[model samples]
Target: MKFPRRRRDPVEVNLTPLIDVVFLLLIFFMVSTTFETRQALELELPESAAGTALEASPVTLVVTERGRYRLGERELGAAELGEALSAEADQARLHGLVVEADARAVHADVVRALDQAGALGVRQVRIATRETQATSTQAETP
Candidate 1:
């Protein structure tokens, strides 16, 4: 007597789940990633409610916490600072010069940057500052 053989089923991989997982991962990364415009120098700008928005982008002079001066991305000494300011003088006077000093930076450093700008004939010099937090003030009844 002859025995009958059973046929085996063909193997198949479902790609729908794999594609779904890939899309999920893509979405997760897009949502979780932070997009921040980071500058060459990190600064905690002082807060002020009196700051006015500029009409044009101007040359920014950054003063670090250690009283170091940074013109754009280039760090400069006191001697080199004058040359750098002079180089930017035309643009500084045309658009303006913004002094972005760290909150912890020495006041003398900031003033020195201003003096340099003034000496270079930069008339419009604005200090960079973040907006101050609004405070609630309730009138007291006597």
Candidate 2:
């Protein structure tokens, strides 16, 4: 003999509330999110809160101890430096020059680089300097 058939209740999950909550959260994050873009140089940058950010990329001129200017890897004389800097500034579309002079470099060499930038009509000339890092021994001694 077969037993009487029993009626089963169907189980259901309501997804409308869950979808609405998820959509609201996604919209909130999209509206409230902020983005920032920052570009940085690898060399040690001097600490200064008063410095102005250059609108154009800068050409770097490294002054050696022997009073020579190095643009990238090429060493140039004071006279040659001016021409090269002007050409680079034009080609690179840069409006600034950064003279990274070594501590032992001659004062005249640094001045000459500055003059070159000025002659090229580069208005944003800036000097890059790094804060002196105390040696481990020096720090320990104190």
Candidate 3:
């Protein structure tokens, strides 16, 4: 009598563990990444009765008491401010300017800076202001 022939089993690759590891790596990278630090130019902003905080970061332009202007930390004149802002706009994809003027700076000077930003195709202009302080005398009286 002839012996029964044996059959060979087919080979297969298991991908479940591979796919799980790939997903874990994706999550690890997402959680491990850090955001870039934003640069700001500090100034003593003028007080206002209706000052509000902005929801997003803006490109800052500081005006000092001596009629000096600066973008970030670089000092610029009226003519140079436009060029500097334009360069920043190109780099940061900014469409507006946030003017931080000192309380002692003239109002017309601030307006002129805003006008220059407008001429450079910056459609939106925001003036930075500090919230008005409530005096103790006023609070006690009322």
lDDT of each: 0.85, 0.69, 0.75
lDDT of 3 by residue, 67-127 (tens): 7787775898776877787777753345467777988888877887887776667776778
lDDT of 1 by residue, 23-131 (tens): 9999999999976544545789999988887764558888889888887667887778899999989999999988889999999888888999898889998888999
**Candidate 3 lDDT (Cα, 0 to 1):** 0.75
Task: Give per-model TM-scores.
Answer: 0.65, 0.51, 0.60
| Regions of candidate 2 where Cα sits further than 4 Å from its true position | 1-58, 91-95, 134-142
Which prediction has the highest lDDT against the true structure? Answer: 1
Lowest summed lDDT across 10 adjacent residues in model 3 is found at 34-43
Candidate 1 whole-model C-alpha lDDT, 0 to 1: 0.85
TM-score of 2: 0.51
Stretches of candidate 1 exceeding 4 Å from the true structure: 1-40, 136-142
lDDT of 2 by residue, 1-142 (tens): 9999899889899999999999999999999996431222123344554555554344678777777777855678877886788678774345456767776677887888887777777777667665555457754543
Question: Can you give the lDDT of residue 123 in candidate 1?
Answer: 92
Ten-residue stretch with the least lDDT total in model 2 = 36-45
C-alpha lDDT (0 to 100) for residue 49 of candidate 2:
49
